[model samples]
Target: MPAFQSTFDALIQSWKLRLQDAEAHETKLPARMETCIRVCEESLLELRQWVMEHSFPCRECEIYFFKQVKPVIKARYIYYQKIHRLHTGYFNGSGLLEKERLEKELRELAQYFTDNDQFFSYYRNGYTHHDELFFVRGQYDWKICPEVNHFDDLFSTSFDGKLAELMAYELLMKYVDGMLNPSCKLTEPATVTPSRSVAVSRLQCTASVTDIVELGYALHAKGFFNDGKASIRDVMTFLSTMLQKDLHYYSRLFFQIQERKSNVTKYLDELKAGLTRYIDQLDEQDQLK
Candidate 1:
């Protein structure tokens, strides 16, 4: 029981971290999503193993499954739904009209989770409380059921573990795509021209913590960060404003600058110079104010 409790705690922690990463707009969310689902699957499998090893009674095992495993899976599905809504709201008025098609795609992706939620509720209610003899009407006897069955067999088939796995995988893929590239318009061809273009590839480049700090410092110098210390939220807000305003125009120039510099140090130097010049101008304006 102690070991099972520990595993369940770890699973909850993993889910929390996964959602935290999503909230922070971390580039590695897809990876974290995989880890999150893997932890749930593993813990559930471990519970099954323990039940078999101890030869626990069917009712006890079912109670354990209901109390422990179901919560993790249910939470994951809810997280997916929340993220989908966040994506939709975040990009709703991004001014990239072409991205409306992608918005439609996102809605479709969200529907998948809605469907899964319905399926989960139906099976969970029946399997958890009723013990295979559901009160609900007229559902065909599940082919996997027998005249009588153990909790393990009932859960193994009715829980539909494979379906859950596939749903998680699909949700992760679409969620990652939507989160990381919300500004993207899939209907248009990706721009190859280096002149003042926002390449789809550039959207994939995530800002590291260090990058955020440096950018924040520059903005602070330009009088954007009123406090001496820049918080993560401030950095994110500045970046979002930049994307919505100036970056859209100069993104191609930035990309061209990156392409021209082969040496890492030179690249950093040139990038810093460009940012510094812009920051100085903003500082001058602030001083005049």
Candidate 2:
């Protein structure tokens, strides 16, 4: 196991502790939600602290051990995936503009890490066998000096470190909601009753209400809702209000929801494509720098 293995292990252990505690005592929704938030927050803090403390060695060592040898890159990749999920989750529930913004950031971050990882790969041989004659000779080779090319500067700078606790917390909440709903894994309930009128023996917008309720059930079936316990009445009421304000809202919401439930391979391909572009950009920058 590598150094990062231990760091991730520690993180997992801490999470397990939180999870255990939460499961044991958090029987209510409020308590469960709080515990889930805490679990996410504490894990994020632990990772942030670890990166700040061990950023140097991880970067330096990984250059030689390319092909995902070090923990830092793997760590970043893992966090990136988590963050992407959160972003997607949020996007699924948000307005179009918000979803677009998150998608942009997701792509940019993916590209940034990909570029950095490729940059490290360039000096892999020299860094890997530092004691070898060829490696030593390469060290003083000014033409390829990393410092002159700002490799050190670029490498030392952690772009992803800019991730904020507030942002992470929001994203994690979205993820937690998705996880608990279980709708993501199973079909939504077949029928959910809407509130019926008890007075005047009259109903209002019954067809519209029924349609909205059906849509909610469909969305829930598609694993759109974050809260599993959110009653049909709750979903129907929320949708009724929103739809009354804007009939086109569901169309937008459904698009994002579909994206959240998009094929996993789609995301994997995006990451791969971003990294490939990053390598090309790194090569261009190397020449310019």
Q: Give the winner by TM-score.
A: 1
User: Distance (Å) between predicted and true CA of 94, model 2?
Assistant: 24
* Residue 193 CA displacement from its true place in model 1, Å: 58
Model 1 local distance difference test score: 0.47
lDDT tens digits, residues 106-206, model 1?
Answer: 44554544445544455435545543333211222566333222224424434334334434545454454444343321123345676535563365445
| Runs with alpha carbons beyond 4 Å of true place in candidate 1 | 1-27, 57-61, 64-102, 109-140, 143-155, 160-289
- Candidate 2: pairs in clash: none
Query: What are the TM-scores, per candidate, against the unseen true structure?
Result: 0.32, 0.28
RMSD of each: 19.5, 20.8
The global C-alpha lDDT for each of the candidates, from Candidate 1 onward, is: 0.47, 0.43
